[model samples]
Target: MTTISRFTGARFLPMVPALRRAADRVPERARLPVAVGLLCEAVLLLWWLAFYPGLMSFDTVTYVWQVTTGHWRSDHSVAYDVLVWLSLQITGGLAALTFLQTVALAASLGYVCHGLRALGVRGRWAAAAPLAVVLVPSTGTFGIFVWKDSAYAIAAVLAFGACAHLAARQRPLLHWWLLAAAMTGLSVFRNNSYPAVAVAGLVLLAAMPRRWRRIAAATLVPTALALALNFGVYPAIGVQKPSTSSYYAFNYADISVAYHRAPQTFRRSDLAVMSQVAPLAHWSAGGSNCSWVDPLMAPPFDRPAAERLNGKLLDTWGHVLAKRPDLMLSAHLCRGRIAWALPRNDSDIFIQPPVVPADRFGYSRPGGLMDHSRFLPALRTDPPSDGLHSAGVWAYTAARTPELTWFLWTGSLWCWATYLIVLRMMRRRPLRSALALAATTAGLQVAVLVATPAGLFRYMAAPVLLGFLALPLLTAAHPADRLPGADPARRGRARAAARPQSAPPRSGAAA
Candidate 1:
């Protein structure tokens, strides 16, 4: 007569043995699959390094210069610079530097694989599919390239792995603090990453209350100090450069604005043209809005560098919030759009010439090229294949390569959907979910070619890694029936239930 619930309650502690036995049944050598997967990934990394030898598109040159020169001491992305410097010192060539990056990424991927295995995802075969899907896409391209994106991806995987371990194990305050510091360092390394760290920290706080405030405070203090060192103390000491007030004139702003005007269909084409022209126009228009000015754009003698930057960052936020609140919201909302933009399958640089067949003649269409409404048709046909490829080129074609256009369109849509899901989820658990949401959103803001509009998929790499780490946690299986603790009263009731009713016993005896 023992009820199922009663039996379950008595077996709680003993279930551990059952679970272990189950785990043991999962083949001792299952790790071989993961090892092989890593090997394949390593091969891909090596091949890309050998063949591409550093694709000449987007931030490739600028980042190389930053590491080689070691100028921007307070420029935030210090870790990546340090890694690059270390590579240059050791190997003595940019190719060597790229190899170093690939190795770092491999290490990060290894850690991620370990984390997945720890979560009961047995065998490499089980892990390979998800890992391949994420590692490929635009992310794969970044893995092989030596860029901030690669470094960010590496640091992010490490940080997130650390965080997931800390969270899953319910570790001590000290452990959480250590992970927070590591995350802070990574965030500082990439300017766009700071907001993401802030957001993610808040999300972690939402989930664990015992040490939530302590964890959040620990994270914020170090981050604030890092910001001080980068924008404030460093500039004051002349270790870093100061800023100027000319950002509005920068072409990125104009491009962002242009995107605001365009419908979602051809945002990639719009961003492509803007990426080429915006910064120059911003520079020509005269001001320090371009990120390059962070080191060289010194503050006037009237105020301390830290104070000046604090004021500027504050003012920038204030202006955006006050004058363009809607734009700010739109930007965050646009994270969804940015996330799903399709891969424009076009070459990152103008290396390969236009390959359209003569039958695809609509590509040669003219007129209405400048208009947003005509933009999609133009992008579909013209394929701007080699038209205005380099950063140095002056003339703007307004036409986008068809493949590139489709990629952006697809990437934008995917980003938007994820953004909305994150947003909706965060509303209920603000502290815990906000960071994931923000990281997903803001990370996309920089990831897509639209906001920062870098060609390499590396820009959005942080969120990409985060999404990977989040997968296991999201799909964790619920214990069908969590065994309850043994209770004497419940045992007594079950014993009583085991006895037959007295009336029935009497009737049987009479018969």
Candidate 2:
């Protein structure tokens, strides 16, 4: 005879009581952090178990090859490759790396949730904000996926969330260092992320009211670290560079589209330069596929020859862009459509079946490319159990659902939304500090648009994750009052410290 409303209010999950009891033991001000920590860690544990060694793809296999073979390259994220190496050494597999990514993400979002709570958001909802951000189909699936973009998204969230936390109240120097680490780590995990993190640091400098010298130093951390690692440390340590031809992949698209649409558009000399890239057939055939430039630059494409003729290719592409702007621009836009306008791009990068492909790890199955003995003893895949199967089904369907695809799966939408929100929040002076978060997302969007070889869903992940985390910040409420049993002196000072920060400080004011 119990009503549905009663069940809605009921704590049916056994873990709820334990989490509540644990939170109750902490001081009132510290309760949210403790709860968030416990919740994030607990959920990640279950999520990791279901996927076991964690999700992997061709890129992961490459990383594994590097680790197992002892040959390393800087084409991919070398720092991230080292992380994979460490995880493999510790767990003898990739599970630990996935765990690190998910936990770090949950921890970062928890910081932002706590900041929202401090800003007077409702207690339960603000505490649950990180849970929502991490548990979404796209994000939850990515949690187990072994990709640098996943870690890149986590670092972006950390940098963004840390900025929100620092802005919420008077924070210690430790908090600034936290932001510094997140910003620096952002680029280290993704080769193309330096520009985004660099701009984000500038956003930090502008948003912060004081501490110019210290803030400037923190701002330069990513720039300095990125440059030193790329130019000095990498070469010093013997990290071989990947094919330089890949660096200019996008140029292939420009030249291909021009030759494809009109063979006569190019002069004899231009045609000669074009052939140096790939055969005319590769260009014409690859033109039909604009999602990526890989087809145009595929096997038998003479990569070293292309590298030598880089100047000629650049000239050809530049000529195409100048003379046949329509074709070139359309091709570029089509290539990067996922970065600008993929509302229905439900293709979450979760390694869909989460099974080992037939062509990897000393195994071969139907439809697999081939088999290799690389991951023999170190890594293997699990047969999808009922729970894992159900979860995969959920992730797949939830991604395709039209209702969620536009908002959750499509990242470009979030990027545009973040910019719009930043513009609106600028009118509310006290909320301007949040622009630092918006700027980081915006910068990432720019990076993907300009540099990404393909418009993959993973490129837009940061904005998607941040969009969900930003929801609780919209709540309007008073800050939680101090409980009677808490330390009165400490609570009083905490409230006092928080009150002054409510008013936006003028530029050049002390921290």
Candidate 3:
């Protein structure tokens, strides 16, 4: 064969010219990270442009209010608002915030794609990493959307990569530190994320290699940082004071359900305690809406009086629970259903309208990106990213198609997937690291179930993202496949391990 033909065959001949030129720009040492990063970034960029700037919900508008007014509140995530505040300060647009999260989404998926190769996903599976990250709407359409859930969900992806790498027996120097950073993000991004992070941390610590225990021990830096941030920094900044009314959703729902089920048997004093928060009629109105608490808590609900009389409210809630555990159980299932099952309410499952609602809060000043947000007008079908918008909408529709819904939208499905991965990993050595992921994932699921105020998919975003990314593991080639003959060039030197090592390694290695 001519030298040119041989060179052409060896180098980039069969690859598409555009991608070949793009790949040539990346250095060999950084190729995997850069390639996967760019691929994921490209998908997110299209989503952002298609939705131009990104998707938002009512909560996002509220976040904008906090960022615009600088009156930080803890009801949502103050840390996340701080990030948006910083991005707006630096780039003068909320789109910059969108870009920043897109980058994070890229890094997270990139890291997972890279680490999965070390955990045995190889050959075609390895080649499919970039596509895998884009396949799930959680990974594809998530970053461009504005929500604190996106931040914590990205953190969970980072943590999953760390756990996978640690379990690979090829833990990089950055593994534990990456885990630490993810934990800190988890602790700060959501109020309920603290206990979940703690649960995951303990599981990781227990599952980590004994020799690496000290190193893994340092990963708990987030614990102290989380405590300080929650207790110290937040208090010093006067972020948001604790309130007994935080539990009002669940407790009030229980009381409402009890009243609806059997109001005649209920004591008058207990009913009076409930009345201090809202009228008996209001309770009945909201009792039927187990999916949302707005009707019971809105307007005339008298939050101050509820706070003042919280002790009595709890006592009443307890009395109802003891008298009618089944009613409370039914209420718990309805309210926290998203965490453990496919949400029955169609509206609750992945509602990302491509437009940010009009900012009603005067906090959103005119003449800024927030104003541009107001003027989004409509997505032009002829615009460049409008194709992506169409494609994403198509994918979103596909995601709801029976089987895909379980994989893409269901939280418990991913939680179960996580346990299966844990079981697979547990069969390997350095046993402690196996449970790290399960802990983070299932722990979050439990936390959401216990404290959930409504049946929203964002509350369980972490599992959906992490679960889909790890799917290749079910048919993984075994980390050993990446060694020797796996690379035609490396096959020459690897012959000494002998036995002709084969042209390419297959999924011969064990779990």
Measured by TM-score, the strongest candidate is: 2
Question: How does each model score on TM-score?
Answer: 0.53, 0.82, 0.81
Q: Per-residue lDDT tens digits of candidate 1, residues 1-511?
A: 4797788877797899997787677554444434544664665453443333433232443344545554555433655656656755665544555555566555555555554443333344335633653344344445545556566666665565555445334355654564665566566666555565665565556545565676567567757866776767666754555243332222223223323433232234433433333332332232222222222223221123324344443444444455556654454333323344444344321221112223222322343212332212211212133332231122112223355434322334434544554444435333342233233334334434333423333455455445544444333222221123312213335546666877544565686
Error of 3 at 104 (Å): 1.4
Model 1 Cα displacement at 310 (Å)?
A: 16
| Predicted structure 2, TM vs. truth | 0.82
Question: Which parts of model 1 have CA positions greater than 4 angstroms off?
Answer: 1-37, 52-58, 66-76, 117-126, 133-137, 170-178, 236-456, 468-475, 481-511
Candidate 1, position 36, lDDT: 42
* Per-model root-mean-square deviation over C-alphas: 16.7, 9.3, 7.3
Pitting candidate 1 against candidate 3, the one with the higher TM-score is 3
* Candidate 3 collision pairs: 207-432, 207-433
Candidate scoring better on lDDT of 1 and 3: 3
Q: Cα lDDT of all candidates, in order?
A: 0.44, 0.70, 0.69
In candidate 2, position 472 carries an lDDT of: 61
